[model samples]
Target: MEAKEKVYLAGGMESDWHEKLKQRFHNKFLFYNPKDHQLDASEQYTLWDLHHIKKSDIVFAYLEKDNPSGYGLTLEVGYAKALNKTIILVDEKSDTNNEFKARFAIVKNSASAVFDNLEEGIKFLERFSIYVG
Candidate 1:
């Protein structure tokens, strides 16, 4: 059997978004949620997160435009870019027209694909991503 693709869910820890994805795609993909690996020290998490990022096949980053100051999300995107990994970015800063206005420059430039919201991005991934069915 082919090995399942590993995904690193990178985003704000303010909600259960990561859990929802894992629940939705648990059988199809293996996921690494940073919150599950938190340590007492910030530096420890940095190293741990990088290690997981290296191991993952795709970095599915869901960054809301209103919550744009994420150091970990930024670093993960840049590192994934350097490593030539697949990156699916959701930059959710939308207008009434549902046009995405918010973006992180580095993540946007590095992303293999970008969407205005998680649902849209998921649809793209399910349709086009090598690992996601």
Candidate 2:
């Protein structure tokens, strides 16, 4: 069997939605929630975020209304883009007006068909292997 891709989970740390992805992907994904390290110093938090993004091969972003302006999530998306890593965005509302949508390989509604039709998303990620090489 082929190795599962390394996926970085990016989203509003306070949202319960991220836990769903964590449970679903388990060992195949790395869940990065800065809120978990709220007690950590600012410098430590910054370093941890940078490290996680650097180590990830792909990013799965959850766009929740709780964080309409998710700075950390946006930063991770930009970093992943700079590293030429693949991105899959999950939003409850199917809005494609965002600039990041143009850059992502897949942008689907998280609440509905996105999870049901995950094969297309995974295949979109497979394309990254070519870039990884």
Best by lDDT: 1
Residue-by-residue lDDT tens digits, candidate 1, 38-130: 586988988988999999989999886666466678889999999999999987743322333344464688899988788998877565335
Cα-lDDT of candidate 1: 0.80
User: CA shift at 41, candidate 1, in angstroms?
Assistant: 1.0
Candidate 2 deviant stretches above 4 angstroms: 27-39, 92-133
RMSD, every candidate, angstroms:
3.5, 7.0
Residue 29 alpha-carbon offset, candidate 2, angstroms:
3.9
TM-score, every prediction: 0.85, 0.60
Error of 1 at 30 (Å): 0.6
- Report how far residue 38 has shifted in candidate 2, in Å: 5.1
- The CA lDDT of each predicted structure is 0.80, 0.57
Which pairs clash (backbone N, Cα, C closer than 3 Å) in model 1? none
Off by over 4 Å in 1: 94-103, 128-133
Among all windows of ten consecutive residues in candidate 1, which has the lowest summed lDDT?
94-103
